[model samples]
Target: MSLSGKLETDVELKASAQQFHEVLCSRPHHISNVSPSKIQGVQLHQGEWGKEGSVIICNYIHDGKAKVSKEQVEKIDPVNNSVTYKVIEGDLLNEYKSFKITVQVTPKGTGSVSHWTYEYEKLHPGISHPETLLQFAAELSKEIDSHLTSAK
Candidate 1:
């Protein structure tokens, strides 16, 4: 089997596409305020928030376990409402040689749709696809959507 793979999922959100994209690119730290149970905190380590090449460490919970990831902002496309992050260090690197995550939000009527993509190369074929991680992302998106919708 190939050691590299990609997985993607789309989540429907009640918040506008601009709002969703802005939250991720401009103020990702607010995610903890929206979903404290899923995302413990997002701390900027280098550069600045929303800027390319910046680094942030995210503390989160997955599968009932707390985990951390240090990621660099690879790209931020305001026109496309997309943001890409490359994992530089984290628990996920234990099984995968490299991991990249991209999120894009698109307008849909008065609401929006958030697309999450995960690309990774495994260290060995023994590792399974990160389906659980995608599920975690989907749930987290829903939580953030709920908070955004309620706050408005």
Candidate 2:
């Protein structure tokens, strides 16, 4: 595999697209309460919640291993319902030189489609691709999708 790569996952969620976008933009801090099994907590280290340039620290569990990701909100597009996060510090940094995750939601028939795009550069050629992390994000999305779907 290449040292630098991108992974895109489209998860179809049975929830309102606007609501999903709102959750990602304005209410991401509440994600822990909405889906504790996927995310334990999220705190704003700088700037305001859901705004660009904000730094967020996320505590989550991936494959039963606890991980912390310090990320900055790089971009937010309300019209497109997209949010991008660039990871600055955390365990992944030890293995990867840089990482970014973008979440986009689009309305589909009777529901919404979540697009997860992961862009990363590995520290070395021997480092494995971040498939597990992608899986973790997909799992988290599924959990949130269910939570929102059930609440409505």
Candidate 3:
């Protein structure tokens, strides 16, 4: 099997695309408040939030295990409502040689859809595809949508 691969999942949200994208790009640290069970905390380690090259350390839970991922904001395209982050350190690096995540929110009628992409290369072929992590992200998206809709 190939050691490098990409996985994607789309989550439907009641919030507008702009609102969802703004939360991720401008205020990701607030995600911990909306999805405390999944994301415990997010701290800016360098630069500023939402800007490319900024680094953030995220404390989260995956598959019932607490994990930390320090990632650098790689790109942010406001026109497309997309943000990409490259994992530079922490738990996931233990299994994967490299990992990148991109989130794009697009308007769909009255609601929106969040498209999540996970691109990674494994340290060895023994490592399984990150299906569980994708599910975690999708669930986190739903939680954020719930919070955004309720707040308005």
Best prediction by lDDT: 3
- Candidate 2, clashing residue pairs? none
Q: Estimate each model's TM-score.
A: 0.98, 0.95, 0.98
- Give one digit per residue, the lDDT tens place, for model 3 in 1-152: 78999999999999999999999998999999899999999999999988999999999999999999999999999999999999999999999999999999999999999999999999999999999999999999999999999997
- Over 89-121, each residue of candidate 1 has an lDDT whose tens digit, in order, gives 999999999999999999998899999999999
Q: Model 3 TM-score?
A: 0.98
Model 3: which ten-residue window has the lowest total lDDT?
32-41
Native-to-model Cα distance after best TM-score fit, residue 142 in candidate 2, in Å: 1.6
Any residue pairs clashing in model 1, and if so which? none
User: How many Å off is the CA of 132 in candidate 3?
Assistant: 0.4
Ranking by lDDT: 3, 1, 2
Per-residue lDDT of model 2, residues 1-152, tens digit only: 57898999888889878888888777888899977877899999999987999999999887788889999999999999999999999988998999999999999999989999999999999998888878877777787888888985
Q: Score candidate 1 by lDDT.
A: 0.95
Model 2 RMSD vs true structure: 1.2
Alpha-carbon deviation at 79 in model 3, angstroms: 0.6
